[model samples]
Target: MFYEASDNDHKHGSFSEVRQDLVSGDWVVIATGRAKRPHDFLQEGKKAFRQPKRTCPFENLHENALLSLSLGAERGKNIKPWVKVVVNKFPAFQRGVCSIFHKTGPYQWTDGVGQHEVVITRDHERSLGQMADLEAELAVRAYQERYRAIKQDECVRYISIFHNHGRGSGATLSHPHSQIIGIPVIPSDIARSIRGSAVYYEEHKECVHCVMLKFEKNDKKRLIYENDHFLVFAPFASRLAFEIRIYPKNHVSHFEDASEAEIVSVANALRVSLGKIFKGLNNPDYNFFLHTSPIDKLNSFRHYHWHFEILPKTSIWAGFEIGTGIEISTITPENAAEFLRNIKV
Candidate 1:
């Protein structure tokens, strides 16, 4: 209900206001300019395409696996690996020796000198949410192993680990896989997040995320799932309708630093959260990504806490979001969390 406008007159210029979110300190545009009724966002459901295993590129992905793990003898030892991490054949950022910044026409550029790997699961249909808890744990272990290997290079400044589920979530292939990209510079979104947390830490001398976690745990209004080491909750100022964030219970600055027990707990929490979403919402498309401390400045980023976030494609972006850089989420996070929490996974 909160909005900001250039002028007080609501009658003129399709008046809109930019509201600053208290938690992340990011702005959101309440576009009364083109406001939408709540129910208008409940669009028709999408049909997920299932490509045949014969045509799927990942089905033959047996070679160049950076790390591979097996399920059990039940699946038979001759079967394809249960989970594997391999170099992305078509990488956004190609691997090469680290490069120095070179100037060109008032712009700076560097060789995309970083590793891009894909974490593939053997199943063509079973996503993380649908997989067994043990299977999900193995996949998460692959992520950690690759992260540990990629972060060792001094040239690498940031590592992005993300999963694209379904076609709507930008998955060109139907197979279940996650991507890891190492880059030379910190992404702008992550930089902003780090700076915001750093400022809060300077003011309060405690982890900002920990403070939020404590409040959310006691409040219980936004919490959906929790384990010994992690909690899943809808963010207070969600950019998307059903945005979910998974945070470690203990304050950990780096994802790579998580212990084996902690990783398993996180995997459990992640699987449950995703399962609830899949069941309750009827398998919506979504993207989940990890946010962790940059590899270059470990000491300075200690105040920052690492977490994973999932954003479901519940709504589409229109002019207001594109023009103002602020997204309008129709559903309040509390309601979304309640809906998700009540669903049995």
Candidate 2:
């Protein structure tokens, strides 16, 4: 279950209170501490960083590709592939033993052992928001293929597939690219989400995300877009303004397990959703990432639901948010969803 404070829930003109996330159990403050209308978050006049093609590292064809996919007749050409996956030139984690914990003066530590690969789209200027449905599907397919390959590594405990859109969102290069990182340890945030799902399942005998999806689809207040196989919506307990999530209509535990049809549907949903944000909010910077079950114990997390979360850089964390470990969203999810729903993409 999720808890949110409606405008009427306020007493003595106080607008803010903490809302707990159903999956991660993290708290967020909604329209209380700081409040703004949805339009106020528009990123008009914000300049996006652009690197010249001559200087951009990803502008040329990539060699030593781990996986590559191409369209129709272009499959065998010497040109670049539609989508390509290559190891990161500078990886945060490297190929090494799954290090055991060692004591270091009362502290425990291990080597940062894992694999990191970059998934690059052929077009340097076209972001996912600007891509055609088929183009986006190819990118999603690349992620799935690379994920399947990386999960074969016994040392990998979790894999993260994420895209950073603009300078503010941490994209060093202007080229459109996503990253897949396989790590030996599960992220703390993901661990909490998994544990929460397990506890909820043990208590209710159903997936927490499935329950949320049912409610969101029926309520329709927080929903942005939906296709036959996927549903995109603004999360009720949004961590940031215009926070969006895309969930498969049917329960799925791992992203790698998604079928081709599901991938196509999700690709369309993602393209439309991101396009809406691009037009509605004046092309703001954003980051989107996949949240799925760990590779090591897939069956143990069947109660979990895999999904994609998109967080636009609408607000910066201040002292209160950083200190309390709770985010503050200036605009409510309902208003955010309503604004984006009417945007023509």
| lDDT value for model 2 | 0.88
* Candidate 1 similarity to native, TM-score: 0.89
Q: Pick the candidate with the highest TM-score.
A: 2
Q: What is model 1's C-alpha RMSD?
A: 5.1
| Cα lDDT of model 1 by residue, 36-124, tens digit | 44344443466765898899988776568889887765454565438899999888887777899999999988888888999999888
**lDDT per residue, candidate 2, 250-326, as tens digits?**
99999999998999999999899999998899889999999999986537888989999999998788999889898
Total backbone collisions for each predicted model: 1, 2
* lDDT, candidates in the order shown: 0.84, 0.88
User: Which pairs in model 2 have colliding backbones?
Assistant: 15-32, 16-32
Model 2: how far is 297 from its true place, Å? 4.4
TM-score of each: 0.89, 0.92
